[model samples]
Target: MPYIKKDFIERLIDRVDIVDVIGARLTLKRSGSSYMCCCPFHNEKTPSFSVSQQKQFYNCFGCHKSGNVLGFIMDYDQLSFPEAVEQLAKEAGVQVEYEESAGHAPEKKEREVDFYDILERAALLFEAELPRHPEALKYLHDRGLSDDTLRRYHVGFAPESWDYLIKNLAGDNQKILKAMTDLGLVNQGQQGKVYDTFRNRVIIPIRDKRGRTIAFGGRVLDNSKPKYINSRESPVYKKGHELFNLDAIRNLRDKNLPYIMITEGYMDVIALEQAGIHNAVASLGTATTPEQMNLLFKQADRIIFCYDGDAAGRNAAWHALNTALPALSDDKQLQFCFLPPEHDPDTLVRSQGAKAMLDYLEHAESLPEYIIATLRNQYNVDDEGGRINCIDRAAEILSLMPDAILTRAAVEKRLADLVGWSQEGLHGSIDDSIEKLRARKAVRGPESTGAGGSGSRMDPNTIPLNPMRAVVARLVKDPELMRAIPEPDKLVAVLREYANDRCQVLLDLMGKIKANPDTTTGALLEKYRDSGKIGDLISLLAARSDAAIEEEGFVEIKIIDLMHYIKAILQEHLTARKQALRIKGRREGGLSNEELIEVQFLETATRQLQPSRKS
Candidate 1:
């Protein structure tokens, strides 16, 4: 990936009016200097999403999703970091400049912009061609698609001729042809010859949540060896990264869809929509992927994967279940609905009705139920040995649930019942498995000395009650607060008394702020954008600080409190050292002159630190 220059990103953020950027997508009501609305990341009745116009950041009290304009666009629009930057720059009327890095050509960025335009142009051409091809229209109409549904989904037909798109889109422009080739719209053969990638197939354009045409899915008109072919992975499109018709689903006004259904193909999605079931998406011709599951869960809390009841469909559903295991949480859910053996979502909805299909969904098997059924079919729970195997496998699978509290407890209880064991026994077994999994995931790498880089050591004790963490979090959210400290150098010296990785991080951050006084919170975090665990810890602390210090001058008071706390800790250390030396002097008839001098110095420092205790 090409690196966008830090200076350029900071400038783009400064120039962006966050209100205008977010307001264009969501309705914003001003609440003092910040704007408030129901968070787009989660469902809620009351407004908890607060956007600070002064700070140029957003924090949601409900879901706790907070970030600057770049993060908001990335999350709400489902765009990658680079894509978010590009889109924001365009909206801010600024041209994005990248820092030169090895192995990355300058033209790759230009190619990316060209890919979006070319894909969109291809969608338009295909939509225009749909009217010209009666056979394609007949195929769609025979499948019970209404004219409104076809137009709404941008359903089109690729001409049977191999050079149809090549002629219409590229013509004789070699540059456009190469770009189309890169975007998977055209194939370049051995002789540098280019041909249309989709031909004689009905094209259903696949889009992102932003409604940009990123790729296309094409289906054959008759019986063919491969019934469908989608655009290959390109700079703009990843196969498993997007779900078909999600753009429409996100745009729905309700925002309270009971569930989002996942199907296997583009036609299934289109047919289901034509049946008036608007909350369905397809996995773009691949088995459900973890990335797809994340996208689905973001739209709605519950996901119902609708698949055919054949052996292949069951296998696909199983793959989906495994993919969804690690992402399971209390707020998110997964269920499986299998259609009749002779039918898929398309055929089932067409034959019975939308209500019948919905009934099948209403009775979908949950994650635990599906897991237990699969295990039961695989092993005989009636036998003692088989029961033991079932217990072991159940423990392993249940350990993948990430939430170690509520979600884990509920799922564990379900598994325990299936295995006919006490919940305590199953809990111990899953606890062991979770520990082993964590052990396997513990990877070792070179240690980092800087807080703004990956592999930096972050002390676990630096969280929750650490006054130093609160100090760092405050400074991170507002670097200008560094000026409130009386003598920052002396404070750094005091912090160093702790001699831990977190203190080192604070030292590094203080130095950065001292050198760059005008830095904003967004810009400061951008410096540690890739600082792995340490970066995450700092952001978490900063959020806590934001929630705590809302009063005027309270932040300054917090900094002062931390300073006093550190001074007290250092004073206690000095007093302890003086007592230890005095004990040594008593133990050995008399101390050396150097030892006596050290004790005198410690006593003087302790007296100066705590005058109230002085006699």
Candidate 2:
């Protein structure tokens, strides 16, 4: 591991061009002493996100996300402090000097350097083997990969014979062979014979973020089990700690828009690049870890979790969601998308055009949406007990959420509606259950939040109506009003009904617009042309574009007053819930000493909300 010094970080931050870093991703218009743009952190049509050049700081007035350059990168791009600093330093062409400590002594440096040198030399030898193998060359041509792509990615072929690699390391150097074994590239047999670890496979070199090849991924051309074999973790490469194509992603990071993607395979990422999507990466064969997520988020504004569409794929996505939820932020977006069943991105793009693949991405569901889908897929949502269990599952996962009240409330409401419960009933029930679970966890030890769903997993997610359709429609008509779409909790008050649930695709459209400000209604119509009825609605809206966008008579509702109306209704639900609790207490030997205080608080709160609810 490379140790970064505090002094080095301070100097890097002082000298780096933050404007250049941020401006490269999105267009920033000048606004007096600062730059202004739409806040990428949340849904908005207004330019509330601002950066002060003089102060070298950024703050979104709407979302209230503020920070200096380092903080900005960490929040918006999802990077760590040290990674952000190193990225800046590399751009500035400065050598990063680390402070020496007892842990990082000078004596340990030279041996590590030799390990790196051996890996570099071994990569060169692997590259040389490609031309010598005609079958491997044919495979590359069959994939339609250009020579430039092959060289750019450092594609290679390892021979089928066991001794091929060990035989040709320039001078039969045993010292190099010993180091190769230590790196896990060669194996010593039970009889003490040495042979290559990766043979009869096409080799794909994996590099560290700094652009040095540290490991390899071998794909078998013939029908075989374990189709892909990655390097065993070594001193230079840590398993589940490195991302494939990371070095290439770094080269294109600054120029792309507010997002990048994470795929499950090496070929998927490479295929995406060939199809003009340069901002993507893949995790090492395992599921994404918290450490890897931190590194990935720092590189872009949003992350698309693209995987296969099989049973294994759904389970993988579920695990990714559980691991990611504990760290979920209000503004950091993670989307889940799957390729058509029986096809990976590589084959999918080959058969369909890149636009078809992109359209699927544009139609992908958000993390909350995907979680609901996955949970629902496993349960019988039409049954009463099934619904309770699904919500129980939701509570178990959501209790780990860091600090997102509004977002959590919105999700809980949606979950309740799916199970045919009134929002108030589900809210009270889930809250009681969640508190009980928390107390249990407090007394016991921490349990693992793994691929296990609370009960049998629910069914795949169905589209919940964005009940705020009447409101969302008026906002979508203006497009500009989307900037004021309120926080999620308030937004949920309008979206809790399933009557106009089909309108959600329209609501999801706003996210696309926020990511790409130049997006037009016509573009959206074409993008969702196959989305059935929603497509027809957008088509009609596109046809009367003049009236919806240019004309003066479109209904212009007072959104603030509407939101206040929704807030009042929510408060009434709470008041009713508290009143029920008191009534039940009276029927069952009166309120407890602890319950008395809660009853008092509710009485005061109910009186406060009565006037607002009446409004």
Candidate 3:
């Protein structure tokens, strides 16, 4: 990757409106000179995340994550460096110039913006047809959907004619056909003839979180061979990565107490939303993906999966549960609700009303209860062989979960009751599962380390005060200390050059401060408006009640400790570098006499610089 110039990054940061960017994702209320919102990264009742429009940076006093606009985009959207830069540039209305000969040109694809633009146009054309087309209107009305719901979902219709879209768009026939084919709106025959992929079908435009129309799903007006047809995976659309009705629900999230209600079909989502249950979303055509789970995690803390009380729904719930384990933290939760065996969300809301549906959700079976019930129905535990197989299968599934002692204990107790195993025997089985998990983690190696030596494996729930972190924290709290450092430029340079993980975000903020000496904390915080973690970092620093006063205070102690920490870090790097030299010598058909002497000299330098263990 071509190195992104610091000046370009700084310019991009300057151009962005931090409040506008962050306000899009979170609800912000003005507090003095800053804006406060509940930290979106963690479940917090209080507004710990502060956005400083003046500083152009954001920091969560609760969580110590700080960064600028680019950092905010990367964290909030889960975008890469280039993606975040591109997004910020778009937001700032700045066109990024690139040199083709500099090896930095974005790899061009034949189907680029034009494809998505065409799809958007196609969606609009389909949407226009909804009100006029009798079959489409009847299909929705028959499903108990209202005009408000249809418009909210941008429901549309694709006419049955093969050339309806192609001819009306007034583009080259071949190019139009190719665009339709690319979007999976039409099929190209062997002879290069074009035809409609969705005929007399109600179209639902599928958009990403950015609210750009990326794909479409069509449902036939009548009983058809294929019940629904969705756009194929293109440069833009991945069905598993998206959830239907997300665009609609996201709009209403601020006013309502957002709770994710997962239904089985697109119409089910529409029906529920029509009934004033606006916090509902659905899977595309298949089971939920981890990507979908992450998206849900962003909007709401509590997720209730409302599926039909049938075998298939139960199986889907199980799959969704497994997919969510890695992503779901203690703060985030998953609940399960099943409608009557024959009734879907649409039928339930229509028959019992929205109030009854909400009541059912509140009283629905817990995930564990649903899992146990599903297992018992699938396998007869009274049969000895069946019981053994069930226990083994349950153990395999439970082993996949991360360390959650209370939840694990509850699951184990339930498993023992179902299998009729003694508590002691079940304890042994749980231990076996834990050991397997540990072995797998060991094989995967340690979590990657950040530039500041903070390991990625460190849980966000537990904030540790290691020496390096203490140094960074002190710098964060007292920007004056930055001036006192002997080689401030070298220190900042090393931090920026080496730290590309979470810690790099901090380095970026520090770099900005160095560039503009007059930059204020409030401005810095606003710049990182999208970084919930940055707000957390600020909260962490601000929450420290003890002040450092010369030699007697926390500041002095931490500063002295930081100096030693820097020495230790340098020693570690030197030792690692020497080891690399030795390995290189062996790889080059054995070291020459001079090379061996030089290796010894390097080792001597490393040993000489090692920090005192007592410090």
Candidate 4:
């Protein structure tokens, strides 16, 4: 085995505090000297996961899963050892320094920090400019925005000068210019640098849930071609993936709030919060995304989508509903609300008091009711054809849900009532819709393969010549197995005789393990540089646990299955080679004597390796 670095491994583990790590994800209360919370890893009615701050470890009595900070991150975030270490290091403010025997170590760039710093500097500059710039000051005053509101939202202004931000930083001019360009603050032109991005506009700093300014949205004071101009998509700013006012709402999330109200624009969110409703946010000039939904799920138990009562607003609400269905779970609830016609949240709050709005939200109809009402208004469902169309479209939407049994039944009963059809007839329609959904799923399922190599299946016989899957499966199950397979070269030799592209990754991992046999699972998984293959490796390892259970007390079946799989792969390879030879023979008239002898030797080897086929 390669030499294990005891000091580095122990140091990495020591740096992480399990209590703090687990506490961040769950609400932990003190129980004696330790902290306890209901395990997030499993659904439990009572607290079972315990964190011992003294020992720097956590144990779940329910699932019997126990580990330190590294294990917690690995299980919770699904991160690798190295990734968990890096995360913990960041959390603990510890810099992990490593040395290599060969070549110079590559210097790490703090891209996230650089982006945040540049944005912070830019925000400060913009805030300074707002007071000095006459046009910017006039614009805010014209909008009737209060001085307190401006300060509360941190509203600022970017000057019209092209080199305004560039000259102020006084650092590397090129580096500053590139950073601005990266943040979409400036554009590169054919003639020279041009200020094609934000200029002479009121800027609103877009923050993440952590209150870090990740990007910005700027709106023109005057009648401009594009009324609102947002920061171009950057490394930190994903317009669809983030929501405005999330930072503020996150602060108040632990108040046992049952739901959060989602508005149509930033102003609506700001106005709602100022009106005493703090749990409101707006999408960044775009529809919500799955990532945003996931973030919301982490905070609130329910979401109330508040859109304008106009046709466009209803359409936007429909789009959000469709995007949300696949992600909606039993624990999460989704509902929709619309303001009075021609009124947004901002206008409504001014006209109707916050109490009236809150009452409306409390008594608002569910999403299904809103959807049905909207459809009925659009199409007259009194007619037979119209009723049929409504059922068809509604069924299509419901089918997208992974577990819509109750929802489907409710919709079916409603449809039967509307269409004046029998309950049995509506039941039959739902069955048909379910069958259609199943057919669609089956068509999209992974293709199957046959032994003949002519069917429309992914041929299991043609395993790639990389044993990464096998190697990772074995390593995760029993890292001590590395003692038997000490060298990567020898492991490769064993793997090359079989099929599985994962073997290549496993060989690379083995090389690392041989160098550091004491390497923890966290470390091994973290150093795996290729993300494209990591998921596959993880799935393979997870599958091995089941395979191990099945193999217990039936050693012969395991060996036979492995041999059979290997033989099938070899057969596929040999078949392809024979076909290639036949094509070459057609081109060159016939095979040479030496080529024929080689073919005979390959055939003999294949025959010796082929396992008997049994029923």
Q: Rate the local accuracy (lDDT) of all candidates.
A: 0.78, 0.67, 0.70, 0.66
Clashes of each: 0, 23, 34, 12
Ranking by lDDT: 1, 3, 2, 4
- Return the TM-score for candidate 4, rounded to 2 decimals: 0.67
How would the candidate models be sorted by TM-score, starting from the highest?
1, 3, 4, 2
lDDT of 3 by residue, 1-615 (tens): 344454576567766668889998889999866789997655578888877675566766564554556667766775656778778788778876543443554433233338768888888999998888987798788888888878877899988787777776635756666667777877788997777777778998888766789888888888876878888887678888788878766665555344788887877877887787878888888798877887787677788998888889878888988887666555566789988898999898988899989998888776578667767887889999898777777776676565663555667788889999997898797678657766877877754223211111232336676545555555554554555566877766554433334256456656766877665443454444345656555434423323242123365566666567665555555566567777987788788787678678757756765655874
lDDT of 1 by residue, 130-233 (tens): 99999999998999998999999999999988899889888888888888888899998899777899999999999987899999988899999578888898
> What would the per-residue lDDT of candidate 2 be over residues 418-449, giving only the tens digit for each residue?
88888888888878887888898887765542
lDDT, candidate 4, 1-615, per-residue tens: 122234554676655556677888888998865698887644567997777665455656664455556667655654445656567677778765554433332322323237778888888878877888777878676555567777888889877776677677534566666777888877778888555366778888888765778788888888887888888798778888788988887667446667898887887776676678888889998888766776676567689999877889988988998887766655567888877887888778867868878987887667667766766776667887888787777777777665554655666676677667787887788679867866888867843221111111122223333333444554543344566533546435645644335245555666767777765543444354234445334423422323342233644444444445444555665665666777888999999998788578667766776776899
Query: 63 in model 2: Cα distance from truth in Å?
Result: 8.0
Candidate 1 TM-score over all chains jointly: 0.86
The TM-score leader among the candidates is 1
TM-score for each of the candidates: 0.86, 0.60, 0.75, 0.67
Give the Cα error of residue 181 in candidate 3, in Å: 2.4
Candidate 2 wrong stretches, greater than 4 Å: 1-112, 161-175, 256-259, 443-615
Residue 216, candidate 3: C-alpha displacement in angstroms: 1.4
Model 4 lDDT, residue 230, Cα: 86
